[model samples]
Target: MNPQALSPRAKRRRRLQQRQTVIYGLLIAGLAVAAAFAYLVFSGTVPSPWTRPITMPEKIETSETMECPPEGAYSVAFGSVKANVFNSSNQQGIAVSVAGTLREYGVTVAEVGNWPKFLRTDGQLQAGKAGIVAAYTLQQVFPTMQVMIDDREDASVDVILGHTYGEQSLIKSGDFPAGVEIVPPAECVPEEEPTEDELNDGGEDLVPEDEETEAPSDGEEDAEA
Candidate 1:
């Protein structure tokens, strides 16, 4: 039947129905989009933009002692030792004051800042492969601090103070490094690599993660073809 032949009342009713259909379609589409977004947020597959990332430390274990001295030398003097102080705690300006106290012992304070990446309870003494002994030297003062290994390619160690940090040197009354000495360069011990099982079960992947940086299937498809 032609709409031109319809009564005026019928025409008005027909137009109203078409308008209702269009409105219902839009509402359904909107509902679908909202449902999809909610799934992405709750499924843990996609992070919501408004949510602050909760980075509760899943790993913070003491690194194995590699027994390495400074880059080439076996030992270093207290005055010549290099170190950096970091405050990760909520305390204000604690690192700077600690650095000053560190300088009094003739230790070189390279840099000081607040590092929030690795949060701790007491403190952490971090050193690279070449700075093991340097870290050990700093550990003398802060003996209770835990040791962590970093990837820095230098002999400078870092001391990250945590929430309960009120540490001071144990040698407060001595000649400050009473008998510090300079060790000549010798054959340095290499860091032992962690096995695959250790990588899968240990605290943090650390060095193993570097070996697995590339995706596991990058060249596998082509090789299989």
Candidate 2:
């Protein structure tokens, strides 16, 4: 078709058709780009533009510190060490039974009673400044027991039995075993805070959607009115 042979109205219609086709193509390309962006966001392949960058704290180096007895601090004999037995279990007379067992091991029973709160583990040996050696000695007697440092100024150690307290001691002995070494106390390390993604991965819904209320019947509405 030659331009000279075409009418003015026909040329105008052809130009309008070309413009419409170009606009439709542009719309389709924009839709395709939008769909790709949405896919990336929903699939977690790329972070959303609205999200802020996270800055983690730098790691701090901690040196190992020790708290030990003074030089020439004599180790007291187990027979001379006094301990208080507290029952945190439901079993009756458990404190007395444990105290008797301690006596058999040559440890003096200072007191036998119930603890203020129940323990979570098998047992715990609460030691003070002067009772560190005594606590380790008790740990030697019960290998699975936990040692906790407390604020008492004296040498007395508190033995609290938990729910898993068995009637008999795991280690059988007439006298305190030799060659038991005491471990010096160390400072605790702080735990790191969780990241944003880690906190969001819990999968728990904090707020639930409210259910829609059913519409009242005409008769019921009229009666209420």
Candidate 3:
């Protein structure tokens, strides 16, 4: 018997099988599409820092360190509160951005100066102090920047951010964008108030009483006699 001339029942069964195959394929394709849609919706609707690709940190870590005077530097610490930011030197100590928007991400070092072994804690870079090494890219938002402390108080912070065009003696080139500036901390001293005596003396002459009297005593001697 010719295969093309199959029995009616055989042809009908073959058609049913083909229809079932197409239906199953369509079902599988639909399921894949739905899964992809669900993933995008969940990941997009939820706000997360991980959403933005951290390209620099993912590639390699870059860093640099410098010694700077707290004065002429930007304030990283205002009173008891510290701005957000951190830094590291070698395997010890972490630095911080003294005063700026970046302060929101400053570092708090549990260790004194051992950066690699230091511990960083803050709400911004919750990745821990280890994120210092991970911050390989410095995007410039300020025309000038500085990291400074309020006093000689130790644990003032390990690093500061500022521009160098001023009297700043330090310059951080690598790991920083070209022409990126590092400003020194500004002076933080309470304004001096004039004392009561000082205020009263403002317009007064400083002539001695004896000098003001001139030679009156010598002339008065004759009147008394």
List the lowest-lDDT window of 10 residues for candidate 3: 121-130
Q: Which ten contiguous residues of candidate 2 have the minimum total lDDT?
A: 57-66
The deviation in Å at residue 159 for candidate 3 is 62
Clashes of 1: 0
- Which structure is stronger by lDDT: 1 or 3? 1
Kindly report which residue stretches of model 2 are placed more than 4 angstroms away from their true locations once superposed: 1-76, 167-169, 183-225
Candidate 3 C-alpha RMSD relative to the actual structure: 17.3
Clashing pairs in 1: none
What residue pairs are clashing in model 2? none
User: How close is every model to the real structure, measured as TM-score?
Assistant: 0.47, 0.47, 0.20
For every candidate structure, what is the RMSD over all alpha carbons to the true structure, in angstroms?
Answer: 22.4, 33.7, 17.3
Please identify which of the two predictions, 1 or 3, would achieve the higher TM-score against the true structure: 1
The CA lDDT at 219 in model 3 is: 40
lDDT of 2 by residue, 1-225 (tens): 898888999999999999999999999999999999999998999889888754321222212322343333344577878898888888899789778878887888977878767777788777665786677677667766766666577777888888887745446664555454454434322223676666668775333347645678666664466
lDDT of 2: 0.69
- Candidate 3 accuracy as TM-score: 0.20
True-structure Cα RMSD, model 2: 33.7
Worst 10 residues of 1 by lDDT: 179-188
